[model samples]
Target: MTRRPYRDLVIFARGGGWGVDRAADGYDPVAVIRGTDFAAVRSGRTETVPRRWEKRTLIVPRRVRPGDVLLEISGGSVARGQTTGRSLFVGPDVLPAFELPVIPASFCRLVRFDTTLVDPRYAYYGLLDMYLSGRAGDYENQSTGISNFQFERFLDAELLRVPPMAEQRRIAGVLAALDDKIEINERVVTATEELLRAEFDALAVTGHGSVPVTELVEFNPRTPPPERAGAPYVDMAALPTHVAGIRSWSHRPPRGGSRFRNGDTLLARITPCLENGKTGYVDFLAPGQTATGSTEFIVLRARPGVPPQFPYFLARDERFRGHAVRKMAGSSGRQRVNAADAADFRISVPSPERLAVFGERAGAAFTHMAGLLAESRALQSLRDALLPELMAGRRIRPAPAPAVTGAATDDAGSSVYAQ
Candidate 1:
């Protein structure tokens, strides 16, 4: 509430430290979220994310309130609205790993701008731009990461050019509009998926007969051949999202891993990540390339008559995950599920007729969801592009977008500013 041209922002570490886990594909929030509590996050998105703990150097906000901006001074680059991904906190008396220092609340500084000086949303966009451009220029990195990465503290100290609040609002308006649309699209996809899955379960009848999923389908060996020297390792990072696909591949070449083939289903056999439904179906594995993944995922192939989508659907089911959780063993702190259990797990395979019917319905839902997912991703990209430009003085004329004018701001051209 200060009219001061410059305000102070404080960042600190609090709560406890977070634990990292191996997600199916990319890593999930092991350190940031509810410390491996996938069950809680799955049940409650916002609450689970916000209340989750991680004892990092918590960036405590100076005077943060609802609707105020929260910038992760440390996380290098972020999409416009998506920057506010998850809560940054730890439980009582906990601390981050001593090796990985977190952003202490003291490290943050608030930019106190008069409402007339700079709209906070607009400032956020500027911050995003600075973050990205800095990365591109390599200004944020200190020599190949062998050196310290101190962009967060540096940015906090760097000065920002504050424009009139009205202008900030206008610039923010356009960017926000795209973000709002993207958010809406994401919700639609999630709602539709949830509804379809719920309906499928309701229609599905429980038959007691059981068979190992491995037997019901064909299995492939994707393990990279024994590493001679510079060969790639089959780490989990190679797996893709949603359906079975490999987006990226690499050969670390240390361990003697096997290889995977096309149409093979990658079932994650690790805790936390396995619980998070980290499964991917390989559409194709380059000949002799031998795709690799973490010993975490159990790779398999569905036999003829089984839809490619069928494996994906079953792998994502909660029941399958529960079986995965039960099969896990090892240290309590970091449970490791074995590949053997995944290769020979019992599943409630419906009759062929039921499998066909359910597959048909699930297929429709997957198609619809896929479209929504693509669209949402596009909208998000656009929104991200405009965020920094509008926020920083990189683009746009000054002027707070006229507060959504039509009795209901969203419908009006200026709706982007709707509180």
Candidate 2:
């Protein structure tokens, strides 16, 4: 393997900047991938990516294409130890999933690899390896509260191992196979949540009586905080919008935040977070365990006769969300909905028998989703562990085996074989 400066192997272009304007003449609507959307996009969830309008003159130059990597060069939290330089690879398959032309937002830069010198996917993996290994932090410069990536310095300072083209493709194929499987699992999770929401909506319409939401669910339910030190802690950022399961959490001393058991639903109460649909079901903890999270969370737990999954789906309901938004109090960006106000939200209650049936159906779907999430976590761990070694050429593996019955393939039509 030969090492070369990162700057020599790729071209960098700034992303676009323009407010969304649907009726603007001579403007084209394009989906803009922001830094906040990195996690979801990486996990194959693109529904949350925002659409903005850009001048037609600027569209062609900033337009994203397959094989390009969108690198976050700005806006990261210094307090959270999340440095800039997160990257997302746009593969051929990812483009078709978007309804509008996609481009990186103003905070990101488009990294285009010179195909003659290196493979794009391989280059992306190299960048990912750098970030995961914490090497990218070396090039981070923080001012005020926002952390920005010193892209030029990083490109000039860091060196990447250039493997042979065949070897590059082979390595990318193996890693992409794992990613593909994880993505497929994400799709199933999304589909399952959608199905549960549909069923819940149907039940809500056909059910007998109307009652206050407090009748079926307890808001900010009182639960003893975790007794032990370093309990699982979920921040507002960990909550997912469309997904039922929380993707990440940390172990920290319980310091007086909203505490809940495994069956509660955590909903973001603050302005942008609430508006962004940040709600997550609490099922990742061990049996009988309690966890604490950000004070901004309003925990929703089902009452005696109600199903555990009911509160989560209800929190996801459009009308319920609208009511919560309307109930928001406080000044400007800090506005939040109080638990008391949210508890006042009303819903139609179904019969006990019907509730039980819906519980069983929703519970099964949630169980399957949990299993899929577990599998994805395992796959992600494997990929993270293998990334550094593979990119550094420390681990030399054989080329992927030829496609057999039902084996997956990459965008280039090459067979994918897991290591």
What overall lDDT goes with each candidate model? 0.47, 0.83
Q: Model 2, 66-131: lDDT tens per residue?
A: 999999988877667777888989988777879988888988988888999999999999889888
Q: What is the TM-score (0 to 1) of candidate 2?
A: 0.91
Q: Can you list the residue pairs that collide in candidate 2? A: none
Each prediction's TM-score versus the true structure:
0.59, 0.91
List runs of model 1 lying over 4 Å from the truth: 1-44, 50-64, 73-116, 134-156, 203-209, 218-265, 280-295, 329-335, 387-419
**Residue 92 Cα positional deviation in candidate 2, in Å, after optimal superposition:** 1.3
Model 1, 27-83: lDDT tens digits are 223223332232222222333232222222232323223223333332322322122
